[model samples]
Target: MKKCLKKLELKIYHVVKGEKIDGVHAGVYGDVTGIWGDVTGIEGDVTGIRGDVTGIWGNVSGIRGGVTGIRGGVSGIRGDVTGIYGDVSGIEGDVTGICGDVTGIEGYVSGIYGDVSGIEGDVTGICGDVSGIEGYVSGIRGDVNDAKLTDNERLSGIDVSQLIKN
Candidate 1:
């Protein structure tokens, strides 16, 4: 039997939704993420990454890094969160993540939505949609979405205000 070292690395834990990765099944990696180790990397790097509680939406992204180990078609390093969900916007009447690295802030929604507008790179720990490195969706209380940022309001390290604020 193979030692499915699911939680072998402390970097990624049960961050994925509905997944229970254990070192007793030895799984593969790929784009068909459905649970904790599925597409064990970014949230929406190419398609789907769901966690609900923002536990593990998008972490290390891009098909680049060192030693991407896992089961399934999910290959890529979620090692240091090279890239998380970036920033984006949603059109009127839109309630889903259109683009950028989207993660559920708080709620039991179906999927993150974004339409018409899209972005590139991670938006896990900074402000503005064009920020550099791990882009933050919302890390602070004063964080105003870039899409919704007003000339009078203050922005922490999060953009998408137009989608968040508006």
Candidate 2:
């Protein structure tokens, strides 16, 4: 009888093989054809895979993952920009963060809590805060908040008719 019809042939077994499958199929004499394995998550667009990626990513061509909010232009950047709150424009390199706000014409920054604006170059911070108008500033530690005097910084002793008010 054709060797008992190859011993009543019927073969079906699946432990896990996926594209989409959903739960609850215990052992012994198993046969799950396709589609039913409680797929909790997975949706559009993913490529490669290496390390460290958290949330909210868009138009990312190159980032090793450490950028938190508001990125525009970004022609070139190298590394080490941490815990940024907001606002960074045309950076060349070198920024170490605690808080935010850096508008650059040139670069080289260190441990700024907030605020450094440059039209030319060279800003060094310790407690770090300066508003506008600079031709030269060296080693500032706290409060230079909203300083605007640029007719060569009003020649070091300001009072040209109280700067034309009234």
Candidate 3:
């Protein structure tokens, strides 16, 4: 009888909205109101984040740090950010930041308040003020309130899969 069946183990835990989850979480989340720690190896939509986060994959919102495969609004990023792909908007930063190629942007992109580098993308119906920039942006339509370009070049290329850890 034992040879006819195989053993299996399953663990399931649901994370509610506005609840606090600390340490590393490797699973799917929905409408996450707050995350007090880093989320690694995530393969689903992570939304409504209200804290500092890092190393997140898939469509993410309201977070920062080494992120990849992200498709959402990013604000207040404060480090070397690499390998970001997909549609994004409202990227506001305060320190040295780096970004990869973006597909398209629509709406407002206000206040890149620090040294930003390597942002390559196409913009449509966008308006805002950028304090400093050292990257490339093409196909811009709309208005830029204020901008300061330093070098305007591609810094380096990075792979999206390498930014995550198992």
Return the top candidate by lDDT: 3
Better of 1 and 2 by TM-score: 2
In model 2, residue pairs whose N, Cα or C atoms come closer than 3 Å (at least 3 residues apart or on different chains), thus clashing, are 21-36, 21-37, 22-36, 22-37, 22-38, 23-37
> Candidate 1's residue-wise lDDT over 1-166, tens digit each?
7876565545655446543445543253654543343444323335343433334454434533322222232223233432323332222343323333344333222223333233444445443244222333433334453334443334554335423422
Candidate 3 local accuracy as lDDT? 0.45
Tens-digit lDDT track for model 3 on 1-166?
A: 3566778998757734556557764655456454456645666665555655556555534434433333344554444443444444444434334354443343445444545444555434444454454333343444443433334321344332333233
Residue pairs in steric clash, candidate 3?
none
- C-alpha TM-score for every candidate: 0.14, 0.20, 0.25
- Stretches of candidate 2 above 4 Å error? 1-151, 154-166
- The Cα error of candidate 3 at residue 23, in Å, is 23
TM-score of 1: 0.14
Which of the predicted structures, 1 or 2, would earn the higher lDDT when compared with the native?
Answer: 2
Give the per-residue lDDT digits (tens) of candidate 2, residues 36-69: 4353344544545444433433333323333343
Q: How many backbone collisions does model 3 have? A: 0
